[model samples]
Target: MKLDFNLKLTQEQRLVMTQQMQLSVKMLQMSGFELQEYIGKEVEENPVLDAEYDTNSNLKEKNNEIDYKKFIEYLNFDNYSGKNYYRNEEETVSPFTFISNKKSLKDYLNEQIIEVNEGEYTKEICKYIVENLDNRGYLDNTVENICEEIEAKKDDVEYALKVVQSLEPDGIACGDLKECLKIQLNKKGIKDENLFGLIDDCLELLANNKLGEISKKLKIKKSEVQRYVDFIRTLEPKPARGFYTGENVKYIAPDAYIRKIDGEYHIIMNDDILPKLKISPLYKNIVSSENNDNDNDTADYVKKKINNAMFLIKSIQHRKSTIYRVLEQIIDLQRDYFDYGKEYLKPMTLKEISYRIDMHESTVSRAIRDKYIYTNKGIVKIKDLFTVGISSQAYGDDISTIKIKNKIKECIESEDKKKPLSDQKICDILKKEDMNISRRTVAKYREELGIKSSSKRKRF
Candidate 1:
């Protein structure tokens, strides 16, 4: 082995973190509500940065609204194809608003319990149980455990559980699945040991729609087992309806709205969420004009503050433009998805879009984080439209894993319950349909879709 001490020169590309990169990531992950909070914080912290709002000014005006149609018309047709001339319209413009009122899980539960008619002791026990309930509405402590903690009798805790269970939605205070079901079943006058035993023994089977196993175990007919299964299916798995109550829902406001107009889709970036920010002209002029020895330190300080303010303004502008560009790339790649919904969502990777948009994969990933798009269909998480692709048997055509999973769901739905399609059979069907998916893929897809295998799905 010869050791060469010769130096070799090579050129390599590297990514450096810039203010634009930092701002891009922040903008991507921030929802409208989060962005509002962030800007408010920034305005408070950055003395030079201030917000100017004109109540009469529309979002378009504040954004220096571009005439999309006129802009597109001015573009040379020879340089771009119909596909390249995509235009997106604004969907809706509304002021950024946030929910100032938020109740903790404990507070929400206590408020509901307060309305119920109960003795002081029972109320105290209920409060203890409510405090111990997990976010999923399951009681984190056993009745005995809670009784010991609160220095109350076990019977008193049990009575409190009964009161909580009897409250709206039937099963709120349960510690586990069995107790939750048992509470609901007891209320329905189903106390028979054999029937209850059937449920306990076959809940796994029952959940997968396997009534036949239950029937055979109980020495009853398939029809009898199905009757019980159907009854159980109606039971609420989530015991806390009140805790999860938000009927008239408000979702995150999208930073951009993509719309289809005259057979073309256009992109409109919503800058309304961002407060109007600029350096104070009066202060800037004063600082620039005062070239005196006595005001050196003051001038330097003012200049530094002004520079920081300008940087912040530029950061926000760059953030908006970067988000718009990233969204444009997403719209181009996921045109079918936006046009036709989830079924048409092609399998797309971050790298592919990043490459197309001349951005780093990580940049693209961050650019889409927690971002949303408001469209004719509704507000959809931008990231939801991009998924891993599953290749089809036919070369040049790839199917999204989501699509294959949906096909499997359809096959199962159309299958006779007595003879549900086996995983291998499902694969065969997909093959016949030219999807060319293997049995393993089919099984994986089935499981992902929460569809059980043939044996599990078989009814009596």
Candidate 2:
């Protein structure tokens, strides 16, 4: 091969993303909560950015307008009663009033230990057992191991285990699932031998709904086994299911609301949770001063800050408009779903919506990511509205797979318990309703819905 050095002029067009463009893309994907946190951090870093809460409902509609001077004058925070940095001191409310006083699982158990009239040594052992419990309220450590670790006798450890297990949840400190079931059963005064036998040995069979096998092994009538199964299903599998685990309860705020005004649906953007951003006039004044021509450093610094602040403000407005347009298209397409119920939910896709809105598919995807909307139906994620389409022969329009799955669930629920509908039977029923789906796809959707097979769902 021969090598030759040559240079040729070529013209080509290419697309590149600037840092501000990347930030705008990222801001579009952030949820309402995440965007608030991001804005809070940006306010701390950028001197020209000033964020203040806008409490007036009348002023919320003006957030999309890019008139910074007019917005600053209209969005004064002097009389604002909402949560913000610049709220009146007299209007501030104490935060401690909202603090949760509920005791955690361990704290709850310790309190019972303290109240018991047991010896101090035994109480200390009880505390150790409580500390060793898993989140499921089952003891993770063996009695022998506890005895060795705390230098206590095996009998004392066993007694302490009993004392801890006897606490309010009824199955706390249990060693295993069988023991937990037995403890809950005993607390409930259920003394059926068949129930105990099923819990002790046939839990796997019971879970799989193998009542016939259980009946054959336990030598009980199938009807009796069904009764025992029904009673066992009422028991709690996890003793700590409802107890607090020292984590904060997070609440979701919808990004927008669809309200029916004057018999017409309208999209209302939720601007309350977000801080209204504005550029500091001080920095703008500094940049516009002619005397600062000699102070290149100060002028450049002020100009850079002002540019960043303006970009941030524009990016926020773009995010709001993009989300609003995306949702407006969604509400138009899924109007029946919002007006009626989930049954009217139609199949939709990002590609279809992007085409209608004249934006890229990726931009549409980012607009709906982690975003939720409040409707007359309830709060639902915008992404959840985009369901896979299944061609329907009856309507001539594509139907949502969610609706098919819902129909299948209804068929199974209404079917006879002694003769549960098989996957093929469910498919045939859906076919009768003009939903043409194969048995395999029906089975797959059923599994996704956490439904068992016909054989496993059958009752004696």
Best of the candidates, TM-score: 2
TM-score on alpha carbons, each prediction: 0.75, 0.87
Worst-scoring 10-residue span by lDDT in model 2: 84-93
How big is the positional error of residue 453 in model 2, measured in Å on the Cα after superposition? 1.5
**lDDT of model 1 at residue 80?**
29
**Model 1: CA > 4 A from native:** 1-34, 53-132, 136-138, 142-157, 200-217, 245-250, 329-338, 346-351, 387-396
TM-score of 2: 0.87
Candidate 1 C-alpha lDDT tens digits along 349-370: 9888888879788877777788
Q: Against the true structure, candidate 2 has what lDDT? A: 0.87
Alpha-carbon lDDT, every model: 0.74, 0.87
Best by lDDT: 2
Which parts of model 2 are misplaced by more than 4 Å?
Answer: 1-12, 55-100, 189-191
In angstroms, the error of model 2 at 330 is 1.6
